[model samples]
Target: MSMSGEDDGPADSGLAPEGVTNDLVELLFFAYRDFVGDPDRMLAEYGFGRAHHRVLHFVYHYPGLTIAELLDILRITKQSLNRVLKDLIEQGHIVQKTGRSDRRQRLLYCSETGATLTAELTRVQVRRVARAIADPVADEPKGARDEHGFAAAQGFLMAMIEPEERAAVRSLMARRARSRR
Candidate 1:
């Protein structure tokens, strides 16, 4: 509704009205906390944390990922990543190989141990996501459903990203899509 107490219809500008997103903000925070809780406990047993889990997760899923690419995806400084990279490498959870084209470039891959841990964590997270997406939506419009039940969820997440960065993010994740086939 507008300030004058009139319905403004749908917000087509793709921007929510001022001061209206607190509920969504809180929902995201709580949802993320719960989503990571299971993995957090499992990681603790290995004396690792979110950083380690994230590094292992990406390396396992995107085999042959470059150090530069991982840094971009994690958005962390090289120094920070170096620390986690060193630990994972030392623990035998990850292996770093020189790029075939550029010896200076480091290509990361999860080792057998890392892959096992990543799979366990992924299974837990996937179950959580599946359950959330399976939430009853009988009252929702028939036009809203999708073949995989991920349309709305994926759209919402992609929309939350900075508009200009969406394309690059999609490009970075393209391998995952292709690998599924």
Candidate 2:
């Protein structure tokens, strides 16, 4: 059957609503694929996968993050987390220590090697992002246009997030930044 909107009535069409461009949906998919491509290849060399990359990224950023906090942030089951955590710890990419205040709690941190790998992966992605943003079509010469473009891009991405989760997302980012200082 032809899926074209021209052949189907509005109610029968599977297209997005007015003002929503289907091109944006496809662009996001392709953008994300390329964005993760470099890291995915590197992780394979270590016999790891995306899960390992995520764990390393989070622990590297949020040093001393509790097992519970990681669990919550990842939204994964304890059992699922245990497998990846065990592999990371065994490979010396991560270390777990007992919390000073709560002896039963395990706090996560990246080892020196983990930090190096994470930084390398992040550098690759950051370079790609910098190039994209610095492109003439994406960003204008220093001025109000540049600032406005940044704001518009930021606003667009933020709006893509679920409304209820936006505050929590912002809080986590701010907290991580403050912790680094």
RMSD of each: 13.3, 14.6
TM-scores, all candidates, are 0.67, 0.66
List, residue by residue over 24-140, the lDDT tens digit for candidate 1: 353355457667778899999999999998998999999999988999999999999999889999999999899999999888988898898899999988876766556522222
Candidate with best lDDT? 1
Query: Positional deviation of 146 in candidate 2, in angstroms?
Result: 13
Best by TM-score: 1
For residues 125-181, what per-residue lDDT tens digits would candidate 2 score against the true structure? 777676555542321134463322343454444444434554665565556557657
For residue 167, model 2's alpha carbon misses the true position, in angstroms, by 37
TM-score of 1: 0.67
